[model samples]
Target chain A: MLPDATLADYALRLGDDSLVLGQRLSEWCGHAPMLEIDLALSNIALDLIGQASHFLKFAGRAEGRGRDADSFAFRRDALDFRNCLLVEQPNGDFAQTMARQFLFSNWQELLFAQLQHSANDTLADIARKAVKEVAYHAHFANEWMVRLGDGTEESRARTIAGLEWMWRFTGELFERDPALKPLVDAGVAVDVPSLRPDWEDRISRTLAEARLELPKPRRWVMGGRVGHHSEHLGHLLSEMQFLQRAYPGAMW
Target chain B: MNAELPLKDRVLEILSQVADPEIPCVSVVDLGIVRDVRDGKVFITPTYTGCPATAVIEAAIGKALKDAGFALKVATMLSPPWTTDWISDSGREKLRAYGIAPPDRGTAKHSLRDVPVECPRCGSRHTEEISRFGSTPCKSLHRCLDCREPFDRFKCH
Candidate 1:
């Protein structure tokens, strides 16, 4: 049997990725360039948050803890967060946001597609629904990538810069954590490393259509799966967790 | 008449009166939100994983059932995942009448063909998508070229 602790840890990692990314995207809610863009980003953020709730709720159950999704989301310190380094990076500009979305959503869609077949019923169920949502996210981001990469000279430059800023983090998405080996062996979790080839193909094809050169990857960054994160996540958590922290079980 | 029917049928009848919070033209049944009812429980699924209206819909359903004197617990089922194909034909017509383009049947195939959405207002085939994300998560914004009217389409999931 796949250990409950392992399952809880894995679910927390997945949940944290969605939660942190949702928080990052929500920052665009009132700040996007146009009203339509603002709504689009917020809608996506809502979806991510929704997905995060499911994962965290399941994580709590697996851990056999009295804590719920809110506890995992609002109580955990940054060192306990297990999201990848890619999602926590600041959304620099329109181009950077789209680049982050494009890279992350492409990998996420692929991961969820495979995860739908997981032996764990809850994870599989969540993945089945999430794969559909992530498909739309990927499509949305890919459209923007092409538009920005092939648009005005200034837009193309920005798009290139955006990809360059986020490329190093891409490698960590496929990293096979040793702790997850038992789950992978038991078919309770996805073999994340197996998802890389398809991710690369789709990204390469999209980049080609955008007339943008593939970024020359720099030194790959890792450790988010092990709870190591950039400085930005602490600030994000403070803002997101403020309500629950201040009120102590505050409810509307 | 509802009282004369079987318990499940009566419960379903009551639920059919509960309108979707966002799209008032359609009921929970019309949208395929109610999956099944058995063993004093109503199995429901949300149209979108992240739709904020999910809790509202569930609460409303629970209230409607309770008010009708049916003792049942609302349960959410995620397996077999909800799809736009589940929306009833009557639901599609109601959506069209309400000015939102109903999703085209067989979304998987339609999406690949890059099918242009027919405008709910003018029936124009020359509609272009304005934004993939709309005011709601389940919709996409589209503009009719002929009428120049922006409308929402219940996007194919």
Candidate 2:
């Protein structure tokens, strides 16, 4: 079995992924291409934030630390975050945003579905709720990918380019750190690498249906899992954590 | 001794008056979010884990309890996640009457596609989805083919 410390770290990685992506999506509140799309993105952001709270809260408890969800999220520096690089990338355009959602949600769906059966009941319960939400997220993103990819030439070109830009980061999603091995053996966590084949097949079929080809994998950029993040995350934290940082113990 | 209902009963009474922040037509108790009241605690499982109103609902419940002279803590329990199946029959009526279609229980909650959505306004079975995302996270937009009325649907699950 993995030590409590390692399990807490695992939970932080999961929590950070949701929290950082939630912040990124929330930035589209009033700026999405359309009003409905705007609400949809914000709604997705809300869900991610909610999921983040559960994971972070559990992590704190496991660590026997006094930190709560708010402190963990609002106090952590970018160097302390562990989200995959794909999620922290800037939302380039409508197509690019959808591409990022499509890729991440598909991977999340697979992971959460498996996590629902985790040995730990808290993790399982959270996953049971989250898996349903991510399924809709993936469906929404896939539909848009199809519409944009098979639409006009300009849209198709932009959609493909968006996927190409995001593809390099996909490699990091399935990286299995040696620390995760014990958790995987104990059925407390998933083996990240084992999820790759299924994730790849799902992406390939969806891309084909969208009339788009899978972008070739290039040199992989990986580091976010161990707290190394792109520059975008630092700027994102500055905005999201500003309120709590500026006013200590502030509550509504 | 003062004449009043028990603390649990009083808490329930106050909770019954608390409206869902988004759907103002129904009370939180009627929505089946109030799981239980025991030991000076009001346990609730917020509907739609990501709904923006979850916090608002919790705050509203806390204020209602405090105003009623009950020092009860509102605890959130996610073990058995909230479901539309928990919505009372009166809550369903309120939703339909208020122009939003409640989730169809027979369909699996996770199946977001091909599920038949009826129009709340016209009661027509010919409704089509306009967008999976609606005005809120827990809803979807649909239009009735017959009435041509666009309405919000409380997406199943």
Candidate 3:
């Protein structure tokens, strides 16, 4: 069995991805293009946040720390975060938001599908429940990708631009951290690189249905998985952690 | 009659009165949230991972059991994740009577497909979904073309 520290680190990385993305989506609570979209985005945010809580809570327990989901979420500094840069990108426009969701949800769904069989029972259990919720998220994003991509000229142009901007960060989602090699070998973690072909096929099919072209792969990849992040993550954390930092243990 | 029942049956009877905070027409038990009651413990599962009502339902169940003088601990189980198919037949009837279309059983296979929904108000097959999401996480917004009434349909998870 892999050490508890390794398992906690793995859980933290997964939890941070959900936590950061959930925060980004919650930004659309009252600001989405339409009422239906506002509710949909918020619902998706809630689901991601919920998934984050479970993963973070398990991480805390495994690490034998008194900290919990909230602590890991609110107390961590930007340099300590482990989310991919894709999720931390600002929601540029409705099209941009949908593009980001399409890319990330597709990858997340594939990752969880494999993680459900992990030798780690807690991670597997969380993945089993999470896979169901993420399906709807991926479906929602894919539908919008098709609509916006195939819609009016202005919509198609915006959709293309959105995909281009977010496409660079896609590589980081499948990054193979050497620290996790042992866990992968022990069946406690997934071989994330193995998910690429299936993810590519799924993304290609969706883009095709949307009448959009796949953006060329970028030469440089992001390193958010190793505590490196874009400028936006620091700004995001300030807002997300303010209540906790200002008045410790403040509660309603 | 309540006093004559076994402790487990009595505990379940109390639980049946605990309505889902969001869908007030249905109890947690009716929704299959309560998986089991054993040794003074109530094992339940949330309908969705991020459902806000999860904490609320747990609290309600805890209160219900406490009020009945049963010191039962409410524990959440995530394995065998909750499915819409768990909604009891009577629960389905209650949801429809409340003007919310209950989810079709065994629809997980075709979740992304546009399955036809029957209008709870007029029982018409002519219903169109307004949004895949609804006022709550477990439902979708739909409008009956014939009756022109917008209603919530419990979505297949």
Candidate 4:
């Protein structure tokens, strides 16, 4: 039997992925280059953040920790977060950000599809409801990827570079850690190892359609599942945690 | 069999009375906010997040469910995120009458993505965007030259 701590940690890991990416997307709330795109990004951000809150709160309960979502979000240090490397990479230029979004949303779409059938009813419930929305997001980003790639020389260069920069983080999407073992065994989580082949095939095809290439394989960065993260996470956590850290349990 | 009553049926009928706070002519169910009724719980999700009007809608749903004789635990779902696609045609009409334009076909013209939006109020194909962000997050600020009136356009998101 795995420890409750492991399950709780895993829950936070999932929650953190949502939270951190949610925060990144929220940065575009009013700042998107296009108005509709602004609403689109904000809507996606809101969904991700909301999902994180639910999972984090559930995680707190499972851990028997006397904490809520806000506390978990605001109080965590960098070392405690467990989101994948792909989501936390900085949103670069529009093409870069779009490319990053394109890759992450595709991976997330596949992840949530299998997640929807999870044996753990809560995770399944979240996944089933989220699949439709993520599908839209994935489609939206992909459309732009294709447009930007085929449109002009500048747009093509930016898209290609953006995808390459983001490629290293792709490896983490399929990683397995101690915490996911139980959920995977229970058939309540997508076996990360199983998703890679299809994820690769689709990404490869999507890039080819856009006239982009699969980035050359480099040393893949791993271990975000166990709390090791890039430097960017600390700054993100600081911003996210600031308000709640300053004012505990505040609600208007 | 009592032709007069089944507890759940009567209960749902009463609960269905909750009207959307944004567009009162239609019930929240018509807006697709109320997804399910099970074990005396009302499961609901907003058509959009940060909508500002969601609190009032939830309160109304709560009151409606209670008034209907069922204790309700209203759950908010975020997956399968809400899109403009979910807005019923009737809800779109409610939006038009409420002074917002119904969503136009090809909200994004990959071809003319930069072109002017047609005004819903005046039917002027000659309209200009005043602000990308509108009076609310869901709307975009637009003005029609023909009517020379400013109005909100339901963004194509």
- Candidate 3 residue-wise lDDT, A22-102, digit = tens: 999999999999999999999999999999999999988878867789999999999989899999999999999999999
Tell me the tens digit of each residue's lDDT in model 2 across A1-252: 323888888889888889988999998999999888898898899899999999999888887767789889999888888789999999998899899999999999999999999998888888888888899899889889999998999999999989998998999998888878888899999887889999999899889998999998699889998988889989999999998999977897
lDDT of 2 by residue, B1-157 (tens): 2338776666777788999999899899878899988876889986666777988999999998888778789998886877777788888889999999988775546557677788998888998887888887778888999999899987777
List TM-scores of chain B, every candidate.
0.94, 0.89, 0.94, 0.74
Ranking by DockQ: 3, 1, 2, 4
Predict model 3's lDDT versus the native: 0.92
lDDT of 1 at B135: 85
Q: State the local distance difference test value for candidate 4.
A: 0.74
Q: State the displacement of the C-alpha of residue B136, model 2, in Å, after optimal TM-score superposition.
A: 1.9
- Alpha carbon lDDT of each predicted model: 0.91, 0.87, 0.92, 0.74
What does candidate 1 score in Cα RMSD to the true structure? Answer: 1.5
Off by over 4 Å in 4: A1-3, B1-17, B22-25, B35-56, B64-157
Error of 4 at A14 (Å): 2.1
State the displacement of the C-alpha of residue A21, model 4, in Å, after optimal TM-score superposition. Answer: 1.0
* Backbone Cα, N, C clashes tallied per candidate: 0, 0, 0, 4
Between candidates 2 and 3, name the one with more favorable lDDT.
3
The order of the candidates by TM-score, greatest first, is: 3, 1, 2, 4
DockQ of each: 0.78, 0.66, 0.86, 0.22
Model 2 ranges off by over 4 Å: A1-3, B1-14, B38-40, B66-71
Highest lDDT against the true fold, candidate: 3
Model 4: how far is A252 from its true place, Å? 1.4
Q: What is candidate 4's lDDT per residue for B1-157, written digit by digit as tens?
A: 2338775455446644777665566567556676666775666776554465677888887877676556667777655555565566876777777777756544522311446766667667788877554545456677888899888877665
- The CAPRI class of candidate 3 is high
Candidate 2 chain A has its poorest 10 consecutive residues by lDDT at A1-10
